[model samples]
Target: MDLVIGRSRSAAARRRREVAERRTRAIAAAAGVTTGAVLVAEVLRVWRRGDAPLPGETEDVVLAAEQAIGQTVEVAVAGYKGGSTRENALLNLHLSFLATFVLTRVSTRLLRERGRWGPLRNVVVGDHHIHHFVPGIAMAFLAGGVSIVSRDEDLDPYLAVPFGAGVALTLDESALLLKLDDVYWSEEGIVSVQITLATLAMLSALALALRVLRRGEAEVLEHDHEIGHGMPGMVVPVPSFP
Candidate 1:
């Protein structure tokens, strides 16, 4: 009789687990579909716009939005040094990566708390919990591989967005990867936050330095141009330093 009861309890537990897994998967699928649909709609709308003016109030709103975005970008990048296309793409990647990391961390914390934060929850399947880092690695790999294969400068900005997002996702769980165990939510998980902040600081500093260097170069070149134009028919001697 006890044995039969034990078996029944075990079966009940397994069913519960299975149900939870299914719920988690369903939630994830729904979120993914919704996000994809929104992205596609936005992309199509923008593509259709293609330099065409919107009607009346809509046109004014769109123009205002564009100007606001431009101003924000300029402020974010320290007065906008007028970087090359590739440099701007790189900046976008860094900013996107940082933003994604922050959002992922917040989302995970909300899910962990089991709050009424929609259907967000940890994904599990057959006694295995799938970490976000898995998808992150795959995304980063695919984006990087395509970028390398295509070798197209024009496509860098597009590829960089996904690459940045993937990197952020993976790094958000850096502690787990380093320890080879699920250390998230533990003391060890703090390492991941530390690493992320350090990375952000380094990237921000590097970007600022690059901008300063570019600005200095531009000033020097402008001065040289002024001097050259001011003294016509004068050949400037090249200075040699041993």
Candidate 2:
């Protein structure tokens, strides 16, 4: 069963820019994700290729060797490696935003219906209420914001700020949950002293976000049958902009 509201915000005569802004925000977030992926890939590629040590390498090489340690200028003419511009950063960010959104919003519903997780097992079996862990609103905002500010190479500042904030908040929220549940200390806790149970919640939320995205996409395919029968599209038009 799909839900169709009214016309999309675009139809209204006012606040045209806000509609466009939402699209832009999604772009920025997508770009940030792309940047992160690209950076990690580059790092791994360089690491695997056995690029020479960064600089001033010694036996006890943990952080002791500074760039200025030997006044080192090893001139082999092999220029440093890095890329300043990547393709469709914002568009990728928007894609990521949607991907995450579906994972959180859609998949959670399916799991709950299928009785996969405990909290929603019969309705779910446990009390985790895992959906709460997914940063739905925030994802929507950052993903949306990316497009709004794409003109400024938003991957760094806007995306990073929220990503940092999200991490901090996730940690804090996990801490609060553990404390509230009175499960802070236990035999299980002792076994995994370094990692908290909160992390499990985080993983569950991420899983939910991913699954929903897949299912939603599938459903979109199924919805093709309804389009011309006086039925709405998979994505309904919201009439809130104006």
Kindly list the per-residue Cα lDDT of model 1 for residues 119-145, writing each as its tens digit: 667788999988999989998999999
lDDT, residue 209, model 2 = 32
Prediction 1 global C-alpha lDDT? 0.65
Top-lDDT candidate index: 1
Candidate 2 lDDT over residue span 35-144, tens digit each: 56644543333333232344344564433333222211111011101112222232233334334433433444466477565543323237754324346347546744
Q: Which runs of model 1 end up more than 4 angstroms from their true locations?
A: 1-82, 195-242
User: Local distance difference test, per candidate?
Assistant: 0.65, 0.39
TM-score of 2: 0.22
Question: What's the count of clashing pairs in each model shown?
Answer: 0, 36
Best by TM-score: 1
Off by over 4 Å in 2: 1-81, 85-152, 155-158, 175-242
